[model samples]
Target: MNQLSTRTSPDTPWRLASLALAMLLSSLGTSIANVALPTLAREFAASFQAVQWVVLAYLLAVTTALVVVGRLGDQFGRRRLMLAGIGVFVLGSALAAASGSLAWLMAARVVQGLGAAVMMALSMALVGDAVPKSQSGRAMGLLGTMSAVGTALGPSLGGGLVAAFGWPAIFLATAALGLVAFAFAARHLPADARTAAPASFDLPGAALLASALAAYALAMTLPHGTPGTLRLALLLLSLVLAGAFFAVEVRSPAPLLRFALFREPGIGAGFAMAALVNVVAMTTLVVGPFHLARALGLAPAAVGLVMTAGPAVAALLGVPAGRAVDRFGSRRVLRLGLASMAAGCVGFAALPFSLGVPAYVLPLVLTTAGFAIFQAANNTAVVTAVAPERRGLVSALLTLARNLGLVTGASAMGAVFLAATGAASLAAADAAAIAKGTHVAFAVGGLLVAIAFAMTLAPVRAAAAVQGERA
Candidate 1:
């Protein structure tokens, strides 16, 4: 059956299976490590701030390298690069599992992140390659489910492994899964056709963009206690580098990012909405565990299970959401997604500790379901609008924007939590403090959704009247 992939059509389940696994691995990498943050802090005799880099290193690495790697896939071959990516991920996972010190672990995570970036960037474009345009929505939906599974499943899975065999078991299991993903990818992914116009790699643009993203992500996600002046400097530097990047892109004949392309309705609006939604959604991933563990006094295992509620909703609804996009339209479904997310934010803002986990779980699930629906519609619209040659880069950009949101959420929301609680550390934060922090964070998240809604409103409304708007 594996050998018959060349003879098999693009619509086969196997093609999507490989892409699904890649999405799963990449998504799980962050949250799984998140679940182990406390353990890592204890094991390495480090502070919460120092140990957080275990998660940030991977995100930073992925965020910085995503576009460059995506372009390389476009110029070279997506299948070949994807194979290399899986191998690198597996190698890094093994190294992480065997790391002797916190520094070594963080370094290994960077390596893992680089590979995960390729997996995420390429797996998305590969879905376009593997499926016909008509089925892209459904295929993307399934990919969304796997990503949801990874995100939702990570805490429970990591918790179980940590309980049974300690922190390293998480990476070991991830590495083993990587091997399986590799095997499927090798057998099922489509080989790239030689391009008539070869990709012109934009070395300067890539460097500037990577630097800007790194600076921005670092400034946003940097743990508190850093000198405020330093964080401000990094933020200012990031803005300068970003301006320089755009300046360079405007000049480069073959730019890394196409500025003119983003002017279109679907592309611009889709990117903004995706980023905002992720920024809002990340609060749950970063803050929910603390609320559950400290505010509600749940154990580690219970925290993991409770955390699964939202992601489980995401996974369950992803396919249906995609089908709805196919049957209705992206704009309509996208609006619904935004509405659900807003309502979820409102729910979280008023969450009461006395009601226990169910109160938290219900809102969380609603938010996650909205995320799944939004991605299915927004991603499908964006991918279909771009040319085949540009799909990989566009796909990478979407993933990059989403990554930016996640890191921003982790850092800013964590900061908000810390400030609201008035605690020096999570260890010191009590039920009342945690409750206050969670409410504050969710309130901020809801406000962001309002902003996102404003940005998206013009485009979706224009899309209704403009004959040129892509679905």
Candidate 2:
């Protein structure tokens, strides 16, 4: 059997270091603030719902900018966009650190989100663009591990900093990290051909997506009993505009998202896998910690430690997963990973509320390991499936799916917890209710992952047939 090689050449080892650093910095920002949410709300005297916007605004902005920035990278160059992202992210961090009001903080977060969007979209695309396809799987796996490291470290780091200094320290630390990434990227990242294409920026589509995501995010953050009428209306409007945007893209010469990519089995299936993995991984990431800390009555520090299991396990398993994908195929690795994740979710559902820490920790580690394997395989499959010119858009869409999954899962869980508890705040009574609600959420998440597992099975079979015939 022949090795699958990326159309591009291998990057220097230093380039890989730069990629890892950029990913780590971006991911650290993704969840670091989460651990500091309570402090942020208290400091600003913001309500629970109002405080959610701090997170929501970032998601909305990132979703809006993802495809647009990615397209620009394909046209201009990946390294350029990465550097720009670092600069913009650092500026946003400065703004966030200086902000005194909630509104200002949200606005600052949006800037950071846009910067993150640029980095994330281009980073994934450049990995494929710069490396041999044979090595791309391992490269992507390493990158994914860096992401896991950032996420795993964020909570504990944020909590420690908040306990010592304040929320502003989180921004400062991330800014410093971003600066280091920028310098490394500037020195080591390889140059790509900046081809000018007929594909100009899709401003109209960008506007539509931005408006839609903003509305949807706003709906998610609206406090319960705060008149669902307005929220429902905004959500409905978002749906309508999203439909229009799709129609326009279908007819446009250069669509923001190349819909044709969906026709490819590997690309489409990989994206579905990405979404499903996020649904399971994020549900565990967001709810598990919240439950352990708030529901199970564990200390905040202990909760952070428990939460660390998933990413830690993923980081450890990432390289092996990448090697398997590169040698056999991503489809097989993805299927196995999804199955493991589903089993972990089932474990979560069956565990008694009074289950010991070890029981819970085992499942957490398994689920995280599955997520790591899935991410590494899926990223390689998606980027390698497409041409170099189109990688950024595909990578952007993949990143968008991951973020949207987190946004949707977190919002849905928050709503479910609120409905179950029937209380304005999280309390001891609310803990039991939240635990029950989480079981249902885990079941649903498991089902979602199972579907992806099923989807990947057929693709693996098909790809194997093609490989066999060629052999």
Candidate 3:
């Protein structure tokens, strides 16, 4: 196998920009679709549950395909997979824009998700490949910033597009952006060198992993009032499939995910830390809006403005945080970031007793800044820990961990809110009830983050020791 060189290439800037654009488009697809949900429901005269499949199907497809596609990129070429992904994504967007029915739209969304999986899985790995280790943190940070900015831009852009031209305009716009990304990628990305002896692909293991992830995501996405027995059955089935996947990987010549990677120093910890931070960060995205609109008596526009503050702060600080990671090393920066997040969580929990929007926004900004810092540092650590050949799988695992965290965190917090408010629907609850539920949910999220903070110490020490040995 031809190892990737450590020397900085001349085309590094353009390569990074191309990868960043891909990341932005992937993030934009997600956020933009969210804003169109209600409009889609009304247009199709479909039930909310049916309309929700649009989002759920996309998510499931992406989650299922990430690991498989990442492995493909590793074996073939990241540049090839990425270019194909963009082409497929653009095609999916066009199909979605021209869909005649809800089912067709949902199917097109699945195609979009399949394309997005390739882009997301290869994004970080491509960065690790193109950028030298010494400067990787900055590139990863920039990519993270682009992702945040894309997500932040989505709702506003989607709303505007839908209002002026209709929901189809959203898909058309995404397709246009996809075309631009494709052009940049084709012009800028370096070609992948072929391996001398490519290992056989693990088709069975891939199937097992896909099945496990799909089952779990479905269970998580099921309606709030879904039958407990049915949920339990799905959970059990997922566990069984996961166990089978593990067994297959243990024996397979080329496993879908090499379990040995986790044995690497600090890699496992980095994955855990990534998942925990996302769990806390996603709580704000999923639950905070309801609290703002219903509990705090803010208008929809006011809620959007307030929520934008956190991501905007994160976007502004992302590159600086990356620079900090490079200067101070990832461990210290990661610890500091986690500490800030914990503090922010505490502040969020206290918002019920506070006076106004400033109180809420301040804590959110703090939390998001910490998340930004943590993401850059932790991503740097995880990618750097693995070998060049394994970076694609590591990237896919990191993305999977994040998706799991987001889904699990949202579900857990939703349950907490329901329990605290003693109401079936968030909309049914009055301001006092919403406030009470928000407090409890934030408190729980804070406690989880505190645990992650403590868990991170050992990995930081391990990483420090390795760096010292190298020095």
Q: Residue-wise lDDT of candidate 1 within 1-471, one digit each (tens)?
A: 222313437446888888999999999986798879999999999999899999989989999999999888888888999999999999999999999999999999999999999998988888767866667778788989999889778877998899899999999999999999999998988777766777678999999999999999898877667888988999999999999999999999988887877798768777887888899988998899889988999998888678777778889988898889878877788878888888888888896878998888878877888888888988888877877777788899899889888878888888898899988887888899999999899999999988877776787567778776553
Give all candidates' CA lDDT scores.
Answer: 0.86, 0.79, 0.86
Global CA lDDT computed for model 3: 0.86
Model 2 worst lDDT run, 10 consecutive residues: 1-10
1-471: candidate 3 lDDT, tens digit per residue: 223346677888888899999999988887889888999999999988889898888888888898898888888888899999999999999999999999999999999999988888899998876777778889889988998999899989999999999999999999999999999999988788667777899999999999999888888879767898887888899999999999998998777787877877778877787778888888898778888888888998899888999889889988899999989888788888888888888888886544778778878988999999999998888887777777888898888888888877777777887788878788688888887887888888888888877877776566578776421
Q: What is the per-residue lDDT of model 2 for residues 1-471, given as tens digits with 9 covering 90 to 100? A: 111242543445777788888888888888788878888889999887778777777767777788788888887787888899989999998899889999999999999988988888888888764566777888889889988888878877998888998899999888888889999999888766645554577778877876777777667656556687998898898899899889888887767776777877677877777866786777886578667875677897788678777778999888889998989887777777887898888987778777757657877877888888888888988887888788888899898778777766766766665555556655544666767766767777788888887787676567678785221
- What TM value does model 2 have? 0.89
Q: Name the runs in model 1 displaced over 4 angstroms.
A: 1-11, 35-48, 162-168, 293-301, 351-356, 417-434, 468-471
Which numbered prediction scores highest in TM-score against the true structure? 3
Ranking by lDDT: 1, 3, 2
- What is the Cα-based lDDT of residue 73 in candidate 2? 84
Query: How many residue pairs clash in each candidate at the backbone level?
Result: 0, 2, 0
lDDT for 12 (candidate 3): 84
Q: What's model 1's lDDT at 11?
A: 42
